[model samples]
Target: MSQHPLARLKRYDIESITRYYRFRPWLVFARAVLIVWKFAGFLLGLRADRGHTNPIRRRQRAVQLRHILTDLGPTYIKVGQALSTRPDLVHKDFLEELTRLQDQLPPFPNDIAFAIIEQELERSVSEVYQTISADPVAAASLGQVYKATLHTGEEVAVKVQRPNLLPTLTLDLHLMRWAASWLGPHLPLNLGHDLLLIVDEFGTKLFEEIDYLNEGRNAERFAAYFKGDVSVKVPSIYWRHSSRHVLTLEWINGIKLTDVERVQAAGLDISELVRIGVSSGLRQLLEFGFFHADPHPGNLFATLDGKMAYIDFGMMDQLEQHDKEILIDAVVYAVNKDYDHLTQAFVELGFLAAGTDIQPIVPAIESVLGNVMGESVADFNIKTVTDKFSELMFEYPFRVPGRFALIIRSVVTQEGVALSLDPNFRILEVAYPYVARRLLSDESPELRRRLLEVLFKDGRFQWQRLENLIQIAQIDAGFDLMPTAQLGLQYLLSEEGQFLRRKLLLALTEDDRLHTDEVRRIWNLVKGEIKPDRLWGAALGALATVWPSATALVTAFTPSEQL
Candidate 1:
């Protein structure tokens, strides 16, 4: 028998590589290719530093990677953009290159775009539009946007998916899956399971991006979430021409946030726009828990009327209620330098494994905080903090939750953009106050009432505990307690056996197609027909007797009254 290459590595490495390889063989190859590309890029970056008089070579390297990503098509472009957010994984120069991976691609044939619109709307181009532009106003990885006018003289933007995108994406994902599976057992990196998880998530997101109907719903959802906000604008979905592949939205006339001169020409206050952008993003993450993940300047525009419009909603991330609370707590702890609470919270949130030593993490957390916390919160440098955090993450090898990583990137990017506009602007000052206000609201009357109910229940629980302690003390004083201890242990074992039996039964019932071997094993375990022991078999026998009574008791508690 041969030892697998993955078997030689540590547990995390084996888990990572095996997880991806189990999916498909081609995905494994894709993973290897990406890793090699990253290493090659790193080496090239080193060479550019070796006696190159022209500093422009570094920028050209980035541009080359961006062009390659673009040429690889939509999925790779998306992967490149995602890599742009991972400063911890990529070098600064590479991050710059990946960021340059433009969402803009050349438009598909105009004839195909027109055909898609006609098919989706069930009308001729002449009937729906007084005038339709032959050229696209914007082109993106998956689709292109054209300017058009309705028969009623209303202007709109028509989004059409690139022809045959679905098939291409499907083929690419299939290859990725295959590569993941084949490479699972050999990789030294913990690339197995995590890689597959990322691939699956990517596939799902890619599919959603191609679905215009989903994008339309996302637009409506964003609009509803920010309904009363006068500063924020989300385009209205023109449902009449919208379909799975085609979307028509209200035409937005605005200058890109990146276009400094154009924005100035339009008489928009740049600083105020940047503030609004940052504030709106904080509200989305902390308040709504649903946000537009792609917040690049191209996706953002500033209207002449001083309103900010967010255009793309194809890529969004949501946080669960518990995850949101954990994030809030983590942020608060980070500010206050509460290392213990932060470590505990990380364990509770499964960011750290159970029984992991915390001593190693405390110093790293303190070191990272010490460098930044000494500075005025308003003047703290985001890039420096980010770099320190990234270094700590790699050194500590802590498992960062996927959503948290994305949120960190989103915040850092927004901060960078804001600082570029106004060097004196303090993101922490703007964001922290809003978070503090929300935290304070958590103690309002309604919340207080809920807290009271919980506290009262906890008080009753304490009383019950006190009564149990008194009873146990009395029993210990009155009796020798040896027989009773043995009996109690036996009863506990019996109860555990019954619980496991019931769980197995429920599982078998849900999955009716259980194999013969599985059924035989279940029967053997429950019936004590094989390898019976006093500890386990006697417990099983006791459970068999008590199971009926327990079922009866549960049935008796059901309410007969109807609402």
Candidate 2:
């Protein structure tokens, strides 16, 4: 057999591609000309149709754009996938069509796939497995998968890379980078980012996806994060069988999450899976800071045991500890409708430059986010927020950072998956509970400050927000009111809580009289949720810690005013 084209290429990096493709200028130029010709034609057509708001015209343009990307091959298909998630970078109609860019392509011949797989594993195909599928199970831009049974009687999915994928992708990326360098300044795109940076980010992630070992490690780390969670499932990677060009892992048996009929037929509750998806997605973003950036319906499935199984860990992203805290802070600011802080959060998150003028941006943030504050949680939709923010992006210099692009994609794709199952599904209904639980349970100083921001404003305690948080948090099975109350008490008695202490005293006193009604309301909300014994015990423990202020604390809640 001929030596595998990728055998000598152990790794891929955008920075090194220029060195490798320097002699391939003619090939790059030819491909660049082809791409420019296709897009230039599309633009000319778009210019003619700019005369009216015709839905049919818009859709036609969208489909044409999708077809162009599909016809351009794997690298462009990957670029389309990234653009599909970036509403800030693409028109809404085009973005919709791009989402339909299913990375699926015709499978390469099985002989070629098997030959490559055997070469990577360095063994005879017959000796490695008890039984292997004669045909490819699934095919995508980069690789195709086959179902095989290991000699140990374990069922596994074997993924084999397409022949010469690295050369094809690397050449395309190098050409695209050149095209962007030449044409970026002339393009009308106002994404507030360097066009080449976007290309580099995409190139880096694409290279990562082709490396099966990197994907296997991503799977293990993802599994470790949810080790004890029974509601989520991650496939066990078989490293001994996996290689740079091939991956083998325990096969997951389940219906795709979007297959509502099949899932219901399997006796699994679709609503429960949606809840699991929301909560799990939250933990990936807000807690672990690592998330599956590509969570399309095909990558998510519902198992027989009612757990959500995550597959294809090839495209995952991580957030720094500080980024996670900033995200949580942004959520708190949005809930409080503190546009100033929200604007600041945007700056910290790289959405805006540090020294950029925030005056114009603050109201824009409010206009998009503030509108949702009035809607009931059950009525709130993430799609609505993203759609409006898409508009906000054009009106200002706001840019979706390269990292944030994946974060937005993961969230929006998760929400899109949920909506496919239930039209009445409101992501906020499930998401707010997770946020509330995180606020109540996490003792991190960042979250503590955020929680305080949510429960206090203008030197007055916001009793209603606290009560609402408790009510919403109880919806999550993982939330325990006793421990939450203990944490709250602990924070209140600590040095940091001194500010809250002063605010609590002021809120309680009106004309030198205690205002007990708000406290009563909170008690009523918690009474049914917490066991009386645990609640009282926690209360006693807190009181013991602050014995000196015990009498005053009790008196503040005593009925001394009209109520």
Candidate 1: tens digits of C-alpha lDDT, residues 1-563: 23334323221233344464566567556755764675586567767578875657777766777776776778788888777666545656667667667777777889888887787688888887889898998888888988998888778988887876654565556556656678755655422136667677777776766778888999899899999889999988889778887888889999888777788888889877886888799778866888888787777889889988999788778877667666666665665566777877778666566787888888877787777867545656666777776566556655555666567667777777777667777676665555443442343333223222321332232222222222322322223223323333344345534643454445445446544554564344334322333334344344445575654554466454410
Best by lDDT: 2
State the lDDT of candidate 2 residue by residue for 84-172, as single tens digits. Answer: 77877898878778878988999999999888878889998888878999898899999999999999999999999889887788888
Model 1, total clashes? 26
Q: Return the lDDT, model 1, position 38.
A: 54
Q: Candidate 1 overall Cα lDDT vs. reference?
A: 0.66
Q: Give the TM-score of candidate 1.
A: 0.68
Deviation from native of the Cα of residue 318 in model 2, angstroms:
0.7
lDDT for every model? 0.66, 0.85
Off by over 4 Å in 2: 1-7, 14-16, 370-374, 530-532, 536-563
